[model samples]
Target: MTQLITERSTDVIAAEINAIKFQTQSMMLQASSEIGKRLIEAKEQLQHGEWGKWLKDNVEYSQSTANNLMQIHTEYNSNPQAFGNLSYSKAIALLGIDAEERENFVQENNVEEMSTRELQKVIKEKQKLEKEIAKKEADALKEKKLLQQDIQDLKQQLEDAHQQSTDHEDSEKEINRLTQELAVAESKAKKLEESLKAKPIEAATVEVIPESVQKELDQLRSKKNESTDPAEIKFKMRFESLVNEFDLTLHALDGIGNSETKAKYTNAVHKLMDKMRATLEGGMS
Candidate 1:
């Protein structure tokens, strides 16, 4: 008997091996899915307490194994074609990903070519990244809420300051009106005294300004002189606003989680303070 020898190129051999691997993986996936489906049916028919005993006696499968198989069936049974290149181990490992993201993750990562351990590592990393992103988003939302509250408080303070300014202006106007009225009254009194003096009457009753009125006029004049200057009021308002803004900046700095970023901002704030101090000292000089 004579046997024929076959010679194949490396490329042809590699292609053949890959084809075989693909067929083998496809069969494995189908077999596991079928087994899982039957196990699910069996569990449904069994009594509530007999599930473990049935698995042990009938199939020698532990509850954990049965659970994994049922879960695999539930996840893969709907669209097995999409994952036809996945081996049983690969499919099982892929279960770590959510159903919604599994297809896209598999396609993007070429999960069919990855080992089970590699797939698990990638899944863990992805989960960790997602958790970090969610935490950052939550922190950003909280910061936004705090900033909005701070803005609302600042607006209220501005409104109050404006109302006070308006009241001060009204008070100044009232004082000016009273001064004008007092001047008019004094002029009329002086004219009446002059007319009496011209008549030379012996029993002329002269109208005299009351002591209380004189004192009240003096008090009004003092108050007018002591009233806050408009420019001074403006300066005070601006200074208070600057102080509040600086306080808000400090508050914002407290929320910084990165030490390097916080330190940078702290240094900037110190420089700004030094500049302001220098400017103020120069003005005093």
Candidate 2:
């Protein structure tokens, strides 16, 4: 019982662990998606810079104002109106991107590439892997079920073989006993004929009761009755067939020798014969 409980507990733990891994995997992908969204949103606002050629080409501004705006932009972390408040669109115009090298690094990805076509390809692949894992788990379950079914089938076959052996043994015994009874009865009939022949023509013949004869008569009748009962006869016949079958099985198994099956079936056959004999006597008495 304790072992069974332990096995069940392990199975439950394995199921829980799988669930947690799947959920954690989803969360990790979601985090990656959040990073992609953040990068895209910052793209436009980082286009313009306060000290860029755009400012020199457009309105002439004091170097000090530009310098102050640059400080403000750095301080505000890319806000256009960094001094107080600013719209994201205006901020991006003044600061093109945070760093030219970093922006270039982000642009190296080929938009036409397969990896870039779908935003959620990684998640889809993860799901596909999960499906393959699930299929493997289901296959394991099927294999275990098949093994259990084989065990059950073997158990039932063992029982049947045992019963067959027992019935065969009983029939053999009954046949032996009836043979003895028939021999005795034939001897008595022969004696009776002899006595009739030896008697004198004028002498009166007296029949003699055999000594201790009740038991013998009962044995003879029982044997005849066993032959007449369809069920008993059927059992006897089947038992003979089974014995033949058992011999063949034993030969085949002996070639393979000392296997679990051989020992199991042999024991089953003995048990069945004993059971059958008991049942026969039980029914008679």
Candidate 3:
């Protein structure tokens, strides 16, 4: 008798648990439909500010709770063919996703088999992944904008440098022509001095050349020797060294990943070259 009573008690306990499960499932079904219907009907009443009191007094539910129920019906009730047998919790977790995504998610994950906790976990993971991707896209767009600005600045700098280069070239050309003329004049003066020495002064009254011409020739020779200036030679050497350094730096920049930084350095190099050219021209002058 004692053994039979124990078996009966165990069966009763199991039956009680099953009954609770059936009642809970029934409550969820009604909440999905009935709660959704009541919320929809109360939309106008809500605008009139009556539904808040109604929800508190008559429905005995918070607005957030009702909102979840409405989302369930909106997402799943009308599309039960796609989202079959979803629990209230799983459907709530899927509220933010659209219909097509709901269908795919349900099919892909066998959402019906998932417990509420498992579904919520997957939803959180999905949201996190989406946020990460959005952040990456935003960062890439920002980086692209910075690069474009750098390129624009570089273009403007190049244009300015080109104009400066033209001016420097003109100055260099004119100075080079004058230096060549001074060299030729010096050579001619040396030949004249030698010729004057070779020709004997037959009479003291006979002038070898005009005093003014001789004085001018001597001044030209002195200026020609001074033109081999040490400062000018040093400037040329420094300019050549800087040019080679700039080339090497540009080559190194090609290996670097940061184009914006490289562009800034390149602009600096161009400015330095311009300054060097100006200094050299001033020295020559």
By TM-score, who's the top model here?
Answer: 1
Ranking of candidates on TM-score, top first: 1, 3, 2
Q: Which of the two, 2 or 3, has more TM-score?
A: 3
> Taking the tens digit of each residue's C-alpha lDDT, what string does model 3 give over 1-285?
455543557789999997777567656765676778768778655667776678899778888988777777666677565554565667778875666787888888888777889888888888776666566445435534543553454355445545555556654544553444433433333443343344322232123234564465445434432444545534443433443344334445444568798788768867986998899899999
The candidate maximizing lDDT is 1
Model 3 pairs whose backbones collide: none
Q: Write the per-residue lDDT of candidate 2 for residues 1-285, one digit (tens) a residue.
A: 355543458889999996775465444434333433443344335465633453456435454444444433343443212112222222223233344332332235221222332414533454566566566445435534543553354345444544554557665555543443344334433433343344321101111122334344334334543454545545443443443344344434444456687778778867986998899999999
Candidate 2, which segments miss by more than 4 Å at Cα? 1-119, 166-285
Backbone clashes in candidate 1 total 0
Higher-lDDT candidate of 1 and 2: 1
lDDT of candidate 1 over 1-285, digit per residue (tens): 899899889999999999999999999888888889999999889889999999999999999888888888899989989998998888888888999999999999989878889998999888877776566445435534543554454455445545555556766544444343334333433443343334322111111223564365445334433444555434433543453345345545655789999999989988998999999999999
Cα lDDT of candidate 1 equals: 0.67
lDDT of 3: 0.59
Query: What overall lDDT goes with each candidate model?
Result: 0.67, 0.43, 0.59
